[model samples]
Target chain A: MRQETSRAQAPIPAVAGIGLRFPHHRAVREDRPAIGWLEVHPENYLGGGAAIACLEAVRRDYPVSLHGVGLSLGSVDGLDPRHLDRLAALVSRIEPGLVSEHVSFSTAGGTYLADLLPLPMTEEALETVCRNVEVMQTRLRRQVLVENPSSYVRYVASTIPEWEFMAAVATRTGCGILCDVNNICVSAANHGFDAYHYLAALPAAAVGELHVAGHALRELGGGRQIRIDDHGSAVSAEVWALLAAAVARFGRRPTLVEWDNAIPALDVLLAEAAQADTILSRERDHAQAA
Target chain B: MPKLRDLQAGFAEVVLAGRFDALAPYLPADAIPPEDRLAIYRNTARAVMTEALRLTFPAVERLVGRDFFAMAAARFVRQAPPDTADLAEYGVALPDFLAHLPEAAPIPYLADVARFEWALHQAATAEDAPSLDADALGAVAAEDQPMITFIPHPSVRLLELATPADAVADAVLAGDDRAMAAIDLAAGPRRLVLHRGATGVCAEQCDADAFAFARALFAGATLAGLVDAAPAAAGTLLAGHLASGRIAGYALQTQTGEP
Candidate 1:
């Protein structure tokens, strides 16, 4: 499936993009801002109505991508064909530039917890994720990028680091990576790993897109800070610094400003996208000068 | 250390079953309390499922207060988790769930109201099918009527309720109701066939013959068998339905024996 889809076409030229939310759909249709591209959660548009119509309108203008939040690719169970079919239908309808799912499972045994739960970095889980990605790509007749998930807990049984698990999935399935910098930072800080090491270890060629989002840190009774990847606030200064590092290393890729909770106004999200654009442009200049 | 499957399975238990005590020992010390971490999953599940329910029963939610709807929805979630990830297709059993609720028993018609809402929800998202043209129906011969079968609209759903619960849907849409108290159970024993009309979904009382025909169609019974079962009113029902565009296609229903 990956081999067949990869031959169809490469995505829109790697540059900064935005995750198009409903609040901003009208603005997107009216203003047509100069961003590299836009991405949306496929589940949100599964029903054909005002939302789907809005997406259709937006897709006509922007290079849209379908980023799935509920695929449960790493489930121990077999892939849900009905879910896959809905996604396929959406893909056919939107003709998105790229379609992606996280390397995490949100459901098991038919009940969906509906959060991107962590997958233990082991050979078995890697195989499960690869097979699922391959199945998804084959059914959709398209290649899909696998995004790294934010982890609140690390499994003691993990045999490899998150980067190695990610690279192995990309290598095995011939899929691309959606490097989510905020997730990397959140996981690293929570688990006591070096975020820079994670960035350095990623398979750069597999990185097809990037996700930058805001997060909040909550201090527990024991004084331990849990960095929640909430996507509720503005992109923090720390996350911006990390984005600079990632952009410097990987060059300008298709970056999306992901604010899922308590979404702000359109201009605010676009401004966040503009900030990412600044970093990507700066990186481009450095590359050119060098 | 537990294997990867063991860990994920344990985490699933924590999130879906609200069992965090067992998960505590497995959690890393540097991380937040496993229960709090688990609460994130709980909140997430609620948010995603609640959002799906909102889309499925917007009118119902508006009819009942959002807070009441959420409470009922939370109970429904615990009782019947989705069978698949296609969230649009997930909540089909919600009406049944509502029917058996002890607290909901007083609001006897609420279950049927939810049933109507579910039917509408299903109709809204079902695949689009082209309406059969008049020329196609005209092509059928009178001699071939014995073998005729009918296709109901892809979005057509028949629901029998104890009250005009559909009016609650209309009331909610009109924003006339501020609370669940506005629901009037005395208004019914209504037998409505909620279906997608040319413009959108509409509900109305299904006269006996039309109701029987719809039931037979949904059961995959042939038109001849449907007519034989309800011989007196079948012809009128058939004509009414055909003209209404409710019957979208027809095929021959072959009988096995002389009857």
Candidate 2:
């Protein structure tokens, strides 16, 4: 459990942020990339060596957000105290502006799948995630934003729509929502739902930060094309449109461009962040005009 | 309909083992079949874990090609699927796993190289702590200094490496896979101290006496006791150590009263 001082400052600025990975750490520090804020997967900085040093240097200039990937917030077996403890230690050390985790689960029976496996949109699943989110918030003493996961499959047991489940998590646990626009686009492509409808259904006030990443379109054997949420390529034109729609709906939150696999040069990530910035600026300008 | 926990349990089983039948009840038979849906998670899991192993044991991957390395990594993942939330901490049992791999039996040196690489990784990722300065060491009395113990840097790791790890690493860094394969691994065991220097984490070969003295000092053996018990040059070895960033900090015990 942590105690938050009322006068605490925001860990991240309300601007375009780039997902800070290891490959571009030196460049980000030396070149001092022009992106407004930086987000890091807290798991990478848990043990704390070079990553921590680079983060410390970067934090001096930019506010950071720890977007965690391995907390398994939806795990039915309960939160791993060890993982939480490591996260708590990292949170205390980094004092990030925003701490976020996925609404999907990753661990079960001591086995970690290492991916944000989707949760069933059932009341039970919602309650489980809400409880875990509460535990995380209480333990970290900071409200953690529960990000919607990209799912390739849906469970038969699920009665709730994904957005409704996301809303329930926030409504129940007082947690914020990290609406990954690309994930919504991917899941919509896979599940035959309109991405706009998904965005429209979200609780606007709970939107903490937004993630815009690229996805690859894969054609299955049956001539079925499904979008894979692989953050390997540049942000697709379609996802950018969805991002514009999301920004229009939720107003401009601190958006991050995530590129994990085969990460490009710092200039490339910075360019993507700049692209996001342009989109945000356009959206903000449009919002003010409206 | 099964409970959420039951669904996750079945889903985890299918993801880990590809046993979709067991998890069929939880999955909806949509346009994309349940098997195909689970395949996405399965592929992601294998790819993520395999990539982690490849990162941790790049030389091993280069030795046996990417295809074979991925296959072996898949097996290792099923055996140990990362207990730690941090991917950096995964592949703990990989060195041992490599030791017993029938495919890797020919290149027994690969396991040692993996161990070396793992140590280097550990040192690089170890907590960053401020190193002790000369002023801090100079503050202690000359007599009490002998009773002092030199603390190794948080990122310092010592290994008795004897394989072609060094040559392979050099070749790997040079982007010459052929040279890495041609490395002669029968080299005699070398005492090395792996530390994150100003440049980065590196493994430097050092004299056995120096390593022994450094190990003793790290183990809380006083300078005078190590001199009496250990072979000569322990003091000289530690002096060289203290002069560099290898000495993280220092502590004075004022003689623990043990001979």
Candidate 3:
């Protein structure tokens, strides 16, 4: 039996937040950036050392969200018991406002590949993903949001559209959707789908969070190119436009600006989050006027 | 349609094993060749796993240079893919993997340098534990002191390397070319004890006897056993370790009447 602590769970505001990576930990701690909130990958903190110690300190002033990249929620083998237990322990300790994992698997044949692999979006994959999401929710004893992945490949066997698959997971498992607007733009560009239609397919009420990140456009020969969700730069103007449309549809959600690689200074990340906050604020006013 | 399990297995083959044909039947052809799309996944997987290794073994990366490190890391990733998702727990086998690689033969000390860096990585993330209580030891009678056993802190790691791996790591990390040149490659068997405290991770070199004693204590040896194993400086070294919070807690064993 799990013992629930009396620590008050901080609710994440419908504003912009920054993905707290290792480089910005000192600045965030010492200078105490006036961001709306903070988000981090729980896997980094589970080992319990200086990283967790830093997260614990930062968690004091901000409403943190655990955005898991390694849960393999779409695995056919089901959720990894140890991973779930560790995540549950972290949730109990941190009492995060929102917990989320991708709508993709990172492990197969008992080997963790360490990158979010795309699912085929077939009925079988949907069943597997929904089952795993339910197991995750049961173990954590809370609703978790599932984020859409940026994919370069699509399978012929995929009967369901990607957005429909995301919606099915939320509907079947009673989970929330973490609409990564940047992923929608990237995947739509890669597979030739409308990013707005992808957003429209999702249940607006189920969208509890949004992620906006930068991507790299890699060029192939013959003027062909692919959008890579590298999350290593500023949010693109196309993604910002798609995010604006998503905000208009979903009204307001906890949007996060994620920059994982080639991370710039703290001010750059804050500026990205501020950009998101501006969109979120604009949407809130639009809703009020309507 | 193939079963989800089969689909995933085929997908893994495509991404990890580089067997693009394994999933060719499932992927619909378009302007982009199937191999090109699959290459994206393959590249990303290799890149992310390599990045994880680079994080844990920066000294090794620095020693071998980035290109060589990436080549070795890619091979290691395929050979011993992480069984768990917590990437911090990943790449435990890279040191041994590097040791056996043919290309790594030229740099004999590279493996040991990796081993040292891994120890430092482990020390940074190991679980926190309280230091041994001094008053509790005081409560024990003098005669029972020898029977006392220690509980080592989770952050403590004892390493005995055949090369001066610590010096190599320090020089490489500090980017001190002169210090790197000054080190003698023939130095044998550096014993170190690494632990995390209030400030950060610390690695300290010790003599043979002190290393033996600390290893024994970490292995759940009774004070009597530790002294018997390394009798020269058992008392002095034990006090120093306790003072430094290397011992998390301790237990006193009582002799059975039959024994």
Candidate 4:
């Protein structure tokens, strides 16, 4: 099955990009924005149609990444073969520069919950995630970046810290990291951890791609607000600061601005991408000068 | 300490059933109570499923209004959580679910509209196939042409509904809120051919004979058999479908099982 696809992709350039939602598909295909690359959810394009054609046209101009949201990489039951096969087919079709899935699991007991539910940072969960990551990398025949998930609940069974578990997955399975700064900020705020320390714990070389998105504040009963990573509006000031911290620690990586819900106009995203690009450009220049 | 499986099972229980008490054993007591954290996951699961259902069945959502549709969709998510991780492929039983809803009984055609929407979605996302061109058909000798079994692309779909679901679909597409209320169920039966041409998927109402011809083609009936069965308009049906790319490809069967 690994031999079925031979699409070798270069590491995505350390420039800013957008998540490429449907509203901006035409804008991307026609105008071919100045962003470095575009990322899409592979499940959305698993079946063919105008969506495939539209992406086909856009691909001619930009380096696309198939960031999967539904791989369920930490499921006790393991990954779905059919989903992997379809994803392999899509990877061959698009030849994306990067392929990634979350550290969280969305499916268990043959039922797929639509949300990316968090995993307990325990030895058992780590072993399961490493096993699933190995399966995905071998089946896809490409090193995939496993992202840290934003969480609301802290598991009582969690014996390890979030950063240690993420680093352990990379060390054991040789998988790369899709370090989502917004998610780190969200989880950090929720769990009362410093986001900067979380960024510092990751192996710099393992950080292959970065995700920055907008989140909403969910006010609970006890004057506690959960920073929900909704990706609806503009990138927050706090998340931008965290992204700056990550870039400073890990150097400029291929960053993506993902705005999934209540998507604004294409220019709004471009503006966000521009903000990231400015940060990237400044960091690169600083590294070169130093 | 609970195992990973127990924790996940507990989490799924919290998200799916909102049984926070059962899940509390695995959830840590933090600044916020464990139940509050569980509530976040519960809300997320329902919200994501609701949004997916709304995207797949927008017309039904529009027909029922937001609050009513959200309530119905939430109930549906509990009854039938997605089997596949792909939300695009989820909601396979929505039409059937709507069919049995007591609240939906007042507008019996809502289920029909959902079915129509799902059909369109299937057509839109179905695989693109290579259509057999005129050159290939021309090369096949005229005598052997009738024996050819033309294949429709996987993108082809048909909707036969009693209600004027097509008109309601049109109103939804046009974003005409007023037109929905004035919908006429008296417009007669709809037998629509939803096919993906070179441009995109389009829906056109077909008469009985044309629909029968489409159904047969979809079922892999050979041209000569179809022509012989309905010889009166064989020429028109064949010509129309062949040009439309609905006749995607063809195969001539061997009489002796040796091609």
Q: How does each model score on TM-score?
A: 0.87, 0.91, 0.95, 0.93
Top lDDT hit: 3
Residue range A1-290, candidate 4, lDDT tens digits: 55652322335789998998899888888887788888999988888888888887787777889999888998999999999999999988888899999999888787888788898888989999999999999998989999999988887678899999999999999999999999998999888998898999999999999999999998876777777888888999998888888899999999999999899999989999999998888898899999
Q: Is candidate 1 or candidate 2 better by lDDT?
A: 2
| True-vs-predicted CA distance for residue A138, candidate 1, Å | 3.9
Docking class of 3: medium
Which digits, one per residue and each the tens of the lDDT, describe model 2 over residues A96-162? Answer: 8999999999988777878898888888888899889989999999888989999888877789999
A140, model 3: CA deviation in Å? Answer: 0.9
Clashes (backbone N, CA, C under 3 Å), per candidate, total: 3, 1, 0, 1
Q: After superposition, which runs of candidate 1 have C-alpha atoms over 4 Å from their true positions?
A: A1-10, A22-35, A47-54, B59-69, B141-146, B177-184, B216-248, B254-259
DockQ (C-alpha) of model 3?
Answer: 0.77
* CAPRI-style class, candidate 1: acceptable
| lDDT score, candidate 3, position A159 | 87
Residues B92-210 of candidate 2: C-alpha lDDT, one tens digit per residue: 79988988989888876778878888888888788777777867867888878777777788888888877757677668757897986687777677788888877788787877777
Question: Per-residue lDDT for A243-262 in model 1, tens only?
Answer: 89988878788898899889
Off by over 4 Å in 4: A1-11, B141-146, B172-188, B256-259
Q: What's chain A's TM-score in each predicted model?
A: 0.94, 0.95, 0.97, 0.95
**Considering chain A alone, what is the TM-score of candidate 2?**
0.95
Chain B of candidate 1 achieves a TM-score of: 0.83
Query: What does each candidate score in C-alpha RMSD?
Result: 4.3, 3.6, 2.5, 3.2
